[model samples]
Target: MTAVVSNSTEYLLGQSLSSRDDDNHNIYTNLLYLDTSSPGFNDPITFPKDPKERENLLELPGNRKVLIAQPAVVTDVGDNIRHYTLDCHGFQYVNHTTKCSKEMFLDETMIKASYYPEVDQLIKDVTGASYVHLFDYAARGPLNGDDGDPKINRPVKSVHCDQSYEGAKRVVMSRLPDKAFAEEVVENRRFQIMNIWRPLEPIYKDPFAVTDARSIPDSDLVALPVIAGDYTEESWAAEPNSAHRWYFKFAQKPDEVLMFKCFDLVRKRMSPVEYFMLRLRTGLKSICPHDKALRSELVWFTVNSSSNQIHDRYL
Candidate 1:
């Protein structure tokens, strides 16, 4: 019998946020719950009974249906972990935002100038990428949880305290703040930023990959091949003569596992200017310190840049 393989996002939803088992049994530290009014939800679908057959893509869990069901409703997410449910039709904005911020080690600031270098160094330590992508914002209300054209997920500003670095304040939005006369017009921008605006569609493609298969049952190794196809083929795309490719040198070992860590720079979604700005942040030596109020403004500025860039390409 084939064991059921869960998507990363779904697996993450099921994780017990406090379990401290071995690497094979660690639990998440957070939980995400969806409001009952969400159109993107439905009864949980059980896995196939077969033990040997790999799960089909459609049969695997996702949030597609939740959005389809409540195309234009406000999605409410509670902070408590026990109330969280992994069973749903489509992914929720609250879920994605919570996950991304957590993954990036970001608080509300999204771009905490003080911790910018530390964030980069951490990523560099792990990924060995000297540079990391960062953005600043003034205010991110739209993405936070504002309701709008039911169909639109406006960007929302998250808040985080800058540790010790000094820089600009709040993120800014170029256009008018969401005029949410009604829930439909509230605009789900935060969802767009967290869910969309990514080089990859549904950035949470397998939100549960690291937490679930790896930390859950020991049987995930058998399911790796199943989850492998869930990722875009572009993840493995190689272009010769391209500046994006990173060649690695590996030492031969009798039985050691040689892991090749490479960044697949395909599907770049940033504008050249945005890319340059990202590069500039790493080299900037002159730093400007701002209070929470001012930092809030800077956050808005970065959000405006992100929104403008996303609109240029998508809207």
Candidate 2:
């Protein structure tokens, strides 16, 4: 059952936010969810090292199909898009104009020299993070067809978050070369692992969608093991929930960026280790409507930030 809730400003499925008068700009599509009904669903592992095997495991018997109405970002409305935040919605869309050319993304040197600084500043401006460390960046597009670019990674269609709470902590500790500094940041300071995503071209098909973090309950998130070579890390895959609200911007431009939180460490009474283990996890949702083959190319930057003073600039 689908219900459309509307207001003078916004239109949503379960809740109304804001929308343009001319068009609601909501897209109805099917998003893949974890099939809890599958036999032996207790143990589910994804092999990132082997794409074919992972795809086979994630499809058909393992996937639950659900039709979703994703609300588009109403850019015409005043400050409507800015209302969504990492603390509230787990994702936010911002207008950021980049000086780097499209061709610059293809080269590693060019990307580091031209594009990295832009992303570094963008994260700082958005989050008000005192220290920002950009650890990784990757370009992703269609799997079968490549536009002669070797650096492009395949787009993921599953509904999953990039990191678990434990996984996020591990990333912070591992990425920092100095063990003492890592421990200090993880223990005393508040930190967040965020991803900045921007389309390399105008989005035509397979637009990226993110769930309202408020709509997701702890019960719906299932921690899954992601195996990469010899190492294993935990990530989250969400079970289908009727209450889940998804949103995306149609025909998203290259200048626009989607900033979302993977893990956020806030001040609390619990010990850092215990807190990370016991706290309910929150992550950015990766929802794509795979009606047509996705020809979109996107650049993703994973940035880690701390509330305290700056230590190392880039790691």
Best by lDDT: 2
Per-candidate local distance difference test = 0.19, 0.56
Using Cα atoms with residue i matched to residue i, what is each candidate's TM-score against the true structure?
0.20, 0.71
lDDT of 2 by residue, 23-125 (tens): 5545544444566566655353544556455445456342333323333332221236656666676676777778987767767788788888888777776
User: Lowest lDDT 10-mer window, candidate 2?
Assistant: 1-10
Candidate 2 — number of clashing residue pairs?
5
Candidate 1 C-alpha lDDT tens digits along 1-315: 000111122322112222223432222222221233454343332224353332242456632222111111111122322222111111111111111332232244434644455433332332233223344322212222234322222221110112101111111121224334212211221111111111111211111110110111211111101122222111110111111111100111111111111111112237754321211111000001111111111211112112111111111
Error of 1 at 290 (Å): 33
lDDT of 1: 0.19
Where does model 2 exceed 4 Å of error? 1-22, 39-79, 147-149, 268-284, 287-315
- Candidate 1, superposed: residue stretches over 4 Å from native: 1-111, 136-263, 266-315
